[model samples]
Target chain A: MDTKTDLLSHHISQQFNNELEELRNNLLSMGGQVEKQVSDAIEALINADSEGAISVCEKDTDINAMELTIDEECSRILARRQPAASDLRLVLACTKASTDLERIGDEAAKIARFAISLTEQGEAPKGYIEARHIGNHVRQMVQDALNAFARFDADLALAVAKEDKSVDREYKSATRELVTYMMEDPRSITRVLNIMWVLRSLERIGDHARNIAEYVIYLVKGKDVRHIGIKRIQAEVFDQ
Target chain B: MDTKTDLLSHHISQQFNNELEELRNNLLSMGGQVEKQVSDAIEALINADSEGAISVCEKDTDINAMELTIDEECSRILARRQPAASDLRLVLACTKASTDLERIGDEAAKIARFAISLTEQGEAPKGYIEARHIGNHVRQMVQDALNAFARFDADLALAVAKEDKSVDREYKSATRELVTYMMEDPRSITRVLNIMWVLRSLERIGDHARNIAEYVIYLVKGKDVRHIGIKRIQAEVFDQ
Candidate 1:
């Protein structure tokens, strides 16, 4: 098998392989933290657990720190090892994935903030079911995207992108429903607007997850599947 | 004087300097393109110029292509020159700056799409004035952020982040006003929602600019400033 068949399987030296493996492990650990934050934030919003929401916001710093460390590791690898080919792509993918994971953390924190507002305003939850549904969907996307990266599976990454489209559709439909509720009640505008913003954050989280998946595709195939249509991505990566 | 006094002035080899210089120039050129896209998108939205808006959307591919080229050069430099110290920071910053610039272009394109939708819906433009006001504000931030990067001026970069706070305030205020309008005339909800989405895009553009400015600070002072509050950032970058 070629060196790239496993990407991280073999390097010139065991030390280099250990460094790359450590980097990937650190990245996955960070992703796991971000995933927990996201799922907890959604739970807080759906359950109206303002204290839990506050904790989610407070812990965002840890996610930020993890990203800084990941970035440093990426730079350290670049400067020290100067790895080429699949190794280089692996480093680049880790760099890019860390950024997306950090952004997903930010979006989850945003949802938590909105949850706090909902609790403070003492409004009965307007869109909790929709939030929970989309939240779970996006959380799964985040998990799967990370799995794709861990396994170097471009096909699974493609599926994450496709699922993002469905999240977008759900976001839009939920938004439309919220807008109609605001129109019908007029008084519900403030409460509904908060939920809409939360939905937007959830949708953006999905986008960041999709972005990570795209980076996985780029890492494995050495082809940029971004901004290109999915059919084109599939054709370029698999069809050929 | 230290080698970092003028980061690009002297390196081990003159050829390395030229490569780094070319990379910086390419990044600035890409930034200029994104700056124009943001401004043009705002103008199209404000003026109800759907044709111009369409042009802005169509041209996003150019910005995406530019980003890819810059990223490739970053990888090339890392693999070949293995830049150290300030040079390494410059390469890392460019890799990051290009990503933010590309996202700014994406946000600008989203604004343009909303503008086209606004024209198609043929509403009387409920938030054009507010949009123009905030659009101009954020566009200036983008320009100044790029200028800071070009010069490695940490002080100017600080100002860009400061401006982002004001832009966020303006966004919140504009959103409130739009919400009020929706309450007053329920029928206006669709148009106002359109405008709200545009305002959000502008605010996000401002955030992207601020992120670029933070990268500049990191490039110059060799500090990570993200997630740190504005006052904390200033203290970290300049106060110490």
Candidate 2:
């Protein structure tokens, strides 16, 4: 290539790199916001703190805006830079991951809404114990998934996917226990239903975390592991 | 530009157009499959067809695979074509829309699982009538959202968003009725809970449809209407 063309190419590449970095930073910030939302919302639920729950709901708009900003950045990079191979995959993964993050924010808001409702009704029930346990697990999954994305660690991502199985088990057992509790005492049915919705939201947060992990795997390995069994994902990551 | 360069540009544009068309067709086909899944699952629930529910669960794998395929195609085109402005928006919208469609499939599977559970227990209860009503509304929303996507109709997309408000109202009323039934007759708590879950899945289906409609608006008007109120969305779309 000519000197002028070579210089131009270097300049474009630098600009593209800067754009990719900005996208990553924006995504990480969004991930952090989502993690805080999940934690705060769950804490509010466990403590029956309506004030905290209200704050979580209020922050959802910021999360939504962050998603749009990251999306626009991804689109801009795709259009202007035309990044190939890994760069393209990174941008795509960022875009997809932002969607999961936004949805996670939504789930957090759902939990917060339930928390507010429960607070209005007065006093926490025993069912929140199970929710707290599951909430911790799901929150960790979200944290690890975001870390995995930040480091582009396929192994960590695969581990996150495997961790979801335990969350599912926890969710199911919790649901069953709650059902039995409700069946025994008709008076607690309404309260238990609210707790059930909170559990459902936590379970969905786990699913979104798993999705984020899958995106990490895709970004790192360029293989789609979504909808595949955990054992297969294990084999794919370990055997490599 | 020289004739050769002009011709090359035209050829590239043609190839990009063809890829976009293929992506659209693939998306439409996936939409059709998802529509079938939602319909069949709800039908199975209404008819107490365990066999149909099992089939719906089985078909989820196919829908998931289709999503990955479309995702890969979108990434490939974005890398190769670097489509700008509206074309880039279309590709991004496709990727986002496919994610919603896949989740809708997941919700359908959840409903089918409930259907299977309900079938194993006993005959259909009166609460399922409410489920059927909401299910039909959710299914119509999905159909209209997909149609809006296919035709790139921002107006139709806006309408879908507005229609979701009614679905929300229907879901709320249905849940209240179910909860009352559960409270009134504790003997039917388990069965009623199952129906409640089905209704929740149906409500989520409507949410996904709304997300798809928002994507349609974004693709057509280059505005992000997510997390915005309906009045603002109307003003944004119509005031222009």
Candidate 3:
């Protein structure tokens, strides 16, 4: 076998293999934390739980710290092990995925801030219903994407990538509905805008999830599926 | 000098040095394209120029293509050259900065899409002024961040990071103003929401620029300044 194929199929060194496994474990840990944060942030909005929202904001620092730590580990592995081919791809994917996880944390924090604002204003409005629906969908995407990464399941990753379109459609519809409500009664604009921002954050969270899924596909298939149309990705994944 | 320091201070190989330079140049090209896209997108919104906005959308594919190319080059260098120390840091930073630049392109496209929607609906509203102001500031941040990357100037990177705070403030004021305007005239809610999305896009672009600046700091000082408080970053940069 070629050196790269050998490296991929067999461990170059036991310590190096352990390091790679540790990196993946760290990423999964960070992903799990972010998923919980997203769910909690959405719950805070739906239940108008300002205290819960504040606690979510407080948790973001820990998530951010985890990202930095994972990133440092990736850099150290690249420098020390000098991994090639598939190993290099795995390290690169970990680095990129951690960055996305951190941003997902930021999006969840934004949602929490909105929840706090909505609570201060008064009762959560009708828009909270739509926010909850979209938020749930996004949280699922994050979970599935992480699962796909854990298993190196290209099929699951492609599925997660495809789900982003429905989230976008839901977000657009929600925005339209919220805008109509605001036009009917201008006094509700402030509250509606808060919900709108929450939906926007959910939509972005979905995007980040899709990015992670794309990274998973890259890692498994040795292909860069980013920027490619979903149709093409589907074709490639199915063909494989 | 020690081996690591010597590697940092001298080229590992002439070809590797050229490849690194090529990566930076590619990033700068992507940055320049994104800067123009941002400017054009804002101008389209302010002037109600749907055609200009559509053109900006068309140009995004090129930026995405550039990002993929640079990313491949970085991966290739990592697998082949196995660069360590500062060199490895540089490649990692490029990989990240290219991702940010591509997302900045995505943000610009979102702005351009908003401009198109506003044109179809009616005349641009007062919020366009705020959007243009914020857009200009964000574009400048992208430029300054790219300049910092080009020169490896940690001071300029820190400055760019600090500038993000003002952009955030401006974004908040703009959102508040738009909401108030919508409250005053319910009929304007649709147009006002469009402008608000544009402002949100600008704010996100500022965040990406700040991220690039952080990468520059990391590249120069071997410090991962991400997630640290700006106050700490300021102290660190100045103390050096």
Candidate 4:
């Protein structure tokens, strides 16, 4: 290539990388907001704090705006630069990560809404420690998944994937307890059911966070480790 | 700028478009499989068909494989072609759609699992009616979103977005009734709760489809209609 063309190509590559760094920062910021929301929503539910719930609902707009901005920036980069190969993957992954992050934000909002309703009602069932345990499990899974994505750590990503099963188990156990609670107390069933939905939503946020990790694995390693068994993923990573 | 380079560029663009078309077809086929799974899962739950539920579980492998194939194809195109502007948007949108479709398939599988368990338990309560209502609404939403995507019709996409509210409404009503059912008879609580989760899964699938429709609007109209009201989207469309 000629000198001018070479310089232009280098400039484009540098600019693209900068955009990616910006996207990464945006995703991490959004991730932080979502994690806080999940944690705060759970706290509100446990404490029955209606105002905390309202604050979570209101703060969702910030997450939503971050998502929109990331999306526009990524699109603008693509339109302007037409980056190829790994650079293109970075752009595509940013868009996917943005969507997942946005949904995570939505899940948090759902939890907050449930907390609001539960607070208005008055009481949760007695001796229901399982929901809190499950919520913590889901919340931690989300935290670890975001950490994995932020650092592009495939091992961390794999760990996050494995952790999902625990969340599933917790959810099922909570389901059983909630069913019994409803069976025993007719009046508390509505409030209890709402909590179950909130639990389910938190579980789903973990699921989406795992998705973001899978994207990270794809972006960094070009491996599609989704749907396969953990043993297989481990073997594949070792073999590579 | 040279004739040879221009010809090479044209050839690559054609190839990139072909890859995109293949990706679209693959995503549509995946969407179709997911739609069937969602419908069959509801049928299994409502009619107590264990075999149908099992098949949905088995078919998940196929859906998963299709998702992997599409992801690889998209990454390959982005790497090889370096498409820009609208072309890049199309690719990014397809990647996003692929992930959404995969999650939709996962939700359907979860529903099928619920169906299997419910069928094993014999019968569910009146909540099954609510499940049917939710299933129909969400299934239609997925169908419309895919149709909107195929046509790249922003108006149809907007309509699909509008339909999400209806699914949300139905989901809330379903929750209220399920709580009532659980309160009325603890014996029926377990079965009703399982059905409520199936409803939640379907509602999430509807949300994912709506996200896809929004991406379609972004791709076709270059407008970010997410988070904004439909009025803003309409006004922006006209302003363009």
Model 2 chain B, poorest ten-residue lDDT window? B1-10
What are the lDDT figures for the candidates, one per model?
A: 0.89, 0.88, 0.89, 0.77
Against the hidden reference, what TM-scores do the models get?
A: 0.95, 0.94, 0.96, 0.90
Give the C-alpha interface root-mean-square deviation per candidate: 1.3, 0.9, 0.7, 2.0
lDDT of 4 by residue, B75-142 (tens): 77766676665566667777778888888888889999989888888856667888888888888988
Better of 1 and 2 by lDDT: 1
Q: For model 2, how does the per-residue alpha-carbon lDDT over A60-164 read when each residue is reduced to its tens digit?
A: 999999998998888878877888877888898999999999999999999999999998988676588898899999999999999988777888999899899
Overall local distance difference test of candidate 4: 0.77
Ranked by TM-score from best down, the candidates are: 3, 1, 2, 4
Candidate 2: segments with Cα more than 4 A from true spot: A1-12, B1-12
Q: Per-residue CA lDDT of candidate 3, range B61-133, in tens?
A: 9999999999999999898888887888889999999999999999999999999999999866868778878
Clashing pairs in 1: none
| Candidate 4 Cα errors over 4 Å, as ranges | A1-14, A126-128, B1-13, B237-240
Error of 4 at B203 (Å): 1.9
Task: Itemize residue pairs with steric clashes in candidate 2.
Answer: none
All candidates: DockQ = 0.68, 0.73, 0.90, 0.58
